[model samples]
Target: MARPAAKARVPKHLVALAVVAILGLVLVADYLWASSSASSSAVWSSRLNLHTGPAGSTPPVAKKIKEDKKSVGSTGINATFADLPAPELKWEEMAEAPVARLDGAAIQIKNLLYVFAGYGTINHVHSHVDIYNFSDNTWGGRFDMPEDMAHSHLGMVTDGRFIYVVTGQYGPQCRGPTTRNFVLDTETKEWRGMPPLPVPRYAPATQLWRGRLHVMGGSKEDRHEPALEHWSLAVKDGKALEKEWRSEKPIPRGGPHRACVVANDKLLVIGGQEGDFMAKPGSPIFKCVRRSEVVYSNVYMLDDGTTWKELPPMPKPDSHIEFAWVNVNNSLVIAGGTTDKHPITKKMVLVGEVFRFNLGTLEWSVIGRLPFRIKTTLVGYWDGWLYFTSGQRDKGPKDPSPKKVKWVALGTVCHCHRCVVCLFF
Candidate 1:
């Protein structure tokens, strides 16, 4: 065989060089992976802190995140909050609102909370905005809304600078809703009109998602039938790009007072009722006739922006929680609201449990209990605290008295899905 075709002499130094090159590549890959993991952990920690505070405002506790990880597992302390029991919330009373009202809209712009128009009393409805300063802990700067704006049951959403107010009951009591829509420039404090809703709705679920203003699922003009119609309008700079609203897929169920939220880039409508009180015509056109209501715990999600998918239901039936929600870490915490009628009394019962919905796990849990039962509670999260104000109190459904008292949730809103070593080290 010609002595294996004169086999080439293998150089020992060359073989050693090849081995070193392979080892070096392996080491490099390991280092890259470690660095990548560290970056991911840091980014996640920062996001967690962001949700607990206002935009661009970092709390002092965030600086200790690194040190906290080091002490997480040293004393057998649990690092993963995924399995941690829900913390009992203790509420601290804060400054009362400028006025007592229900069915209003509230949005947070940095440290300021703007409370919009709502039902004041039987024939009275507020047509002004009350600004609450979270930093100074005071309610100041009261301004009037648009002259023709709907007072109660108005669907409202804020794009940080502009507050968009949509279809709502024009007057107090069982009055019909107006299709008129308006947008408020928080900077100039000027109100401009937007395209009217194709169909008038009462307390329609309104949100800004993916550069479109979405409004859906509320009582129809009858103020009793659920409006399944879904509509969206391309909007920019507080102005509607399209001439009219474009209709989308109908909701699985149509109802008013549902909690509509955009979390994790998904649209969620949770816990509402099909039927509502109707206006009885008489000497007093504003008289509201009580109607049978069917409270539900059904939770629906829209992820593809086209189809509606049902997700896990709430722990119990809830409604009038349209604004009683705050974004926590990977979850949504809702405050007090009305629930289904009591079994024994056969009367409407207000919700007291503060429920949490985990977006990651798609589950619901009673995270804590509110200090008292209330409905139409306006919620806001700031500086590691959950705040709620201006809602109808625990009195019977017949009582329309609204409260101005505000409360701050005192407890850690922590839910971790990763361990200390896995997330940090």
Candidate 2:
């Protein structure tokens, strides 16, 4: 009788209400557990993002990554300043150049420097060729270029053994721009002619890359008018073949005296002066004419030879007629150029600042300054050293003084650690 009384049915509404209450309690517990888990994950993420390095010191790998991302697009290649240290340059005075000259081209091959024609004393251009032997630190071998091929403000490049000299001013003080091309055999000390450039130009940057010769950025017959045309000459049978100068994409803008170098299989054109070089009033070359020299700091790179991509500009506007630049490891080291102008000093001042451009990042940084100002000098890189020889200091344009520097400054580029050891121990 008691079991039957307990089994009496409860109200349907009350039973449904009890079930809903139990479900609400379960839902509240689940939300609390999820919120706690989310908060713990947030704390973990915050800790991960707080990773820091030593005060005032860069984490080498992380810094490299950041620089690469900023300079070049994501290249997936990591480089550190520690491994490829900023070039430690040391200037040591060596034997003087045989002759004082400017606006010449020089190349280093097998511990020897072959300096080509440039302007000599009395503002006269000469065809004199001199050689500097590193083994003895002496300038001995002396030769003259062919009377016809001898010219200053020419574009020159070397493919290890052969030095290719391209178009340049003919004579009469940088008047005639010739299309003549020639090659010199270093071992035999012989010179041979090659196919001429399609159009005559002077001060165009020339380089040999992947069996082709690239010529870019120079002036036409008039030294002032910049040429925007670009041309390439192919090589066959280990020699620059005689063929038509194949036209390629023009530069973004034309300029004169732009520094050209082949680094990382890419062609880079550095700062130069824009516009034409009009003759100034009372000038010896072309008197009573207005001359406008516009300097630039822009940089452009041509990787495929069909398109030019603008890169980070130089730190300052520079149009040093004769400056030295070379590809050192992954950097383009530029040294000893006048700032903002070519004449360097109407007031007798020149720039000794040295800078380096990182190829991976396409970024430029000041490495160090030269001991003294140099312009119109031939710079040569050999065996981890840069040679700055026979350049002019800040002499007034009309000074007529011996503008050519006699001292040969050797900049031994070493790693930072090696430089430190040399300085201390």
The TM-scores, one per candidate, come to 0.74, 0.68
Question: What is the per-residue lDDT of model 2 for residues 57-156, given as tens digits with 9 covering 90 to 100?
Answer: 2211111111111111111112210011223333334565666665777787777788887765424666878898655557878887977794777888
Instruction: Kindly report which residue pairs in candidate 2 clash with one another.
Output: 224-276, 224-277
In lDDT terms, which candidate is top?
Answer: 1
Q: What TM value does model 1 have?
A: 0.74
lDDT by residue (tens digit), candidate 1, 1-425 = 46556778899999999999999999888756643432232212312222333344433232323322111111111232111233333334556465667677888888788888876655677889988776556788999887788998989888899888998988877888899999989999998999999989998999999999999999998898988999999988889899899988889999999889999888889999989888786637767877889999999989997888999888778899888887777788887788766554555666656687878888887655544456787877666556677665543222212222221110111000011110111
Query: How high is the CA lDDT of each candidate model?
Result: 0.71, 0.60
Residue-pair clashes, model 1: 0
- Our model 2 lands, by Cα RMSD against the true structure, at 25.1
